[model samples]
Target: MLRNIPPLLSPDLLYSLRAMGHGDEIVIADANFPGSSIGPTCIRADGSTASEVLQAVLTVMPLDSFVPDPALTMQVVGDAEAIPEAVTDFQRIIDQVADNPARVQSLERFAFYERAADAFTIVQTGERRLYGNIILKKGVIV
Candidate 1:
C-alpha cells in the first residue's frame, strides 16, 4: 500500500491518470454500462460504486478548468430539465472533492456514450443505480 494514495487506485489506474493530458476526459461508469463493448481501453473498478471511484480519483487527479463543465453525467431518459437522485449524489461527491467543483452537466444518452467513447480511458464501477455515470476532464497538477 502506498502512503497518501487512495488504495482504490490501482497502479494501472494511476498510470492512466498520469498519462492523460489536460482537457482529456475519463469516464466513471455504472456497473450496467457496456464498458467492455464500448472500447478496449477500460479499467474495471468492479464491486465499487461510481461515486466512491470518483472520490478516489479526485483525490489525486485535478479537474480541468478550461471547459465549462469538467464533469458530465448522464441525463435521465425522457427528462431533460430534471436530475435523478443518482446525479445528485454525483454532484455532491464532486463538490466534496474539487475546489472549483465544476458544474455537473447533463448529457443525452447518445451524447454521453459518444463522450465516453472519446475519453482517454473509461473506469467501470459497480454502481447498481441507473444513470450513475459521469465523465471528468483532467487538469494540470499546478
Candidate 2:
C-alpha cells in the first residue's frame, strides 16, 4: 500500500490518473452512468459514492488552471439552475482541495455525456443520487 494515496483509488484508476496529461479530463460517474459504452477507459469504484470518488481524485489531480471551468456537472433536465446534493458536495471538495478555487459549470445532459465520452477515463462510482456525475480536467503540477 502506498502512503498518502486514497485507498478508494485502485491500481488501474491510479494508473489512468497518472497517465492523463494536462487538459485531459476524467469523469467521476454515478451508478446510472453508461460508463462502459462511453468509449474511454473505464475504472470501477463500485460501492463508493461519487463524492467519495471525486474527493479521492482531487486529492491527487490538480484542477486545470487554464480553463474558465475545469469542473463540469450535468444539469438536471428541465431545471438548468438546480444544484443536486452530490454536486454541492463536489463543490465543497473542490474548494478544499484545488490550488485555486474553480467554478463548477453545469452542462446540458447530452453535452455532459458527450464530454464524458471524450474523457481520458471514467471512474464509475456507486452513488445512487441523480446527476452525480462530474468531469474534471487535469492541470499542470507547476
Quote the lDDT for 13 in model 2: 94
Instruction: Give the per-residue lDDT of model 2 (tens digit) for 1-142.
Output: 9999999989999999999999999999999999999899889888899998888888899999998999999999999999999899899999997776698998999999999999999998999999999999999997
Top-TM-score candidate index: 2
Scored against the true structure, residue 1 in model 1 reaches a CA lDDT of 84
Off by over 4 Å in 2: none
Those runs of model 1 whose alpha carbons end farther than 4 Å from true positions after fitting are: none
TM-score, prediction 2? 0.98
Question: For every model shown, what is its TM-score relative to the native structure?
Answer: 0.96, 0.98
- Alpha-carbon local distance difference test for all models: 0.88, 0.93
lDDT of 1 by residue, 1-142 (tens): 8899999998889999999999989999999998878863889999898988999999988898888889998888898778877789988888888856877998999999988888999999999989989999998777
